[model samples]
Target: MALRTRAVLVHRRTELDELLDRHATRGQAEFFLRTRGRTLADVESRHEAAVSARRAVAASVPSDWALAEVERADLDRFLFAPEDVVLVVGQDGLVANAAKYLDRQLVVGVDPEPGTNLGVLVRHDADAVAGIIAALTNPPGRAGAAPSAVRCDELTMVRARLDDGQELRAVNELFLGHASHQSARYVLTVDGTAERQSSSGLIVSTGTGATGWSASIAHDRGGRRLPGPTEQALAWFVREAWPSPATGATLTEGMLGDDGELVVTVQSDRLVVFGDGMEGDRLEVSWGQEVRIGVAERRLRLV
Candidate 1:
């Protein structure tokens, strides 16, 4: 049987929604913003634009295909099918967040406000969504079809797995660090060498995430530059590795090849692992737990 073309629309909360949640009412939110020298009209205008773009995209969906809309916070709970075409209608961060849960599905990043926001992942504007979706559902050489104007680029991802079977994937970077502002204790093993170390945290980053946290570390340390977004290798760095009698700071930075892996044994009582800057949603490991970080088998197909 042929695969069904189901469109899954993904979005995040608007600025107005967040403000209202904190203040409890529109009047209260406006008052709170006024105290900060900001106007409520600015928030309302941006919210209206986002809503309009969402409605326009919804109207453009094919009537014969299955359609589903999901919020960013509920992405982990939602079940994504293999044949689903995911449309992320938000910032670039949302695309990175959605990439973790997705398998091989084709994702199109749609920027609601093309004039105001600049996005690296969300390259397409709202006006081009209909054409992109139509081309994706029906490619060239098919009956009653023209050549597809849509193009897809594959991005590498990073994966982390615990010894007990829990795992997480990230399109940007994975942060293994202490739960609070303190030193994180762990045993780092890479390339047949193991060393005990205490540091601020560990960052395992994909090529796609090189421009973010990994880039900063590379610049400060004068280390090797990161790979491109489509490269298969990953860069690992230990942030502020502190040397001590019990913990050695050697083997703090290196590249992880396609077949290579980084093993970290948790010595801290409250060590957390999170990806794509979503620290609130993280995995906690106690002393003696082992976590392996490496390049993931799956890649993000961006259309």
Candidate 2:
């Protein structure tokens, strides 16, 4: 088929014609939920307004065509074929479900966060979403790729206590960074070595997170000024690219930094450490206890 399905954005303010233009060029159909900084609960009002403005828009489309922010439970509407992919045209905010799940293959992020593959982001107007959908239903090639990993009972989500007396949770990594400060200062101790830090903080991204926070700081942007094993070296190699190979390797505590100590320091006081990107743990932070961090074996699911 020559692609006829339509794709929808995250129900935010969007440029209709520009979106449609993508379709004109690509020969696909797309649409955006033109919004005005409305809350998830407020999409209904906006939808009503859109209906009043162009009743034909809704009438021509099926009743289940549009997805609302209030009830976004199923991915069935987006999933079509093994070759087809759906675009959840939205930003990372109150309306986004990226935080809710780690399905990068299905929910590709268009915007650039500290983590994530900005390269694959579907950054077009409403029309682009439609175009993508149209192109997907009758994709050009093979079905979805074979599975590499999935969730399991062996996999666990736990809440641990920081030396500073705060609790933290993680699925893949326990990343620490300056949310609003210039620097975050903390010592790194893998196994039993103490090393100081000069950067923002330490990061421990998982293999499951093949394209997230680990992807951002994976660059060797002069952090390796020191000589080889004598100076500080986090991993064996830091890719000049995003979503580097650092994701799938095992982090056996001895792979972080100087003498197995992954110390980190940012210029800011308001520091944050969490798994994925969702806020899990808050700590004042001090250097005393042997930070027991071990790379996890299992990963999670999304689509």
Highest TM-score scorer? 1
- lDDT (Cα) of model 1: 0.87
Tell me the spans in candidate 2 whose CA falls farther than 4 Å from its real position. Answer: 1-160, 164-166, 221-271, 279-281, 286-291, 296-303
Q: What C-alpha RMSD separates each model from the true structure?
A: 2.7, 14.4
What value does the lDDT take at residue 38 in candidate 1?
A: 96
Q: What is the C-alpha lDDT of each candidate?
A: 0.87, 0.35
Q: For model 2, state the Cα shift of residue 289 in Å.
A: 6.5
Q: Estimate each model's TM-score.
A: 0.94, 0.35
Residues 1-303 of candidate 2: C-alpha lDDT, one tens digit per residue: 333323232323333334445546313332233243434334344344433323322233333234222113343233433232233434433123332332223332233122232232323333233333323222334332323332111222223345555455444446565554344444444454544443444555433332455545553333322222112233322112122232211221224442333433323345665554555324444434423343222212222
Q: Write the per-residue lDDT of candidate 1 for residues 215-244, one digit (tens) a residue.
A: 999999886779888899999999888887
- The list of candidate 1 runs beyond 4 A from truth reads 138-149
RMSD of 1: 2.7
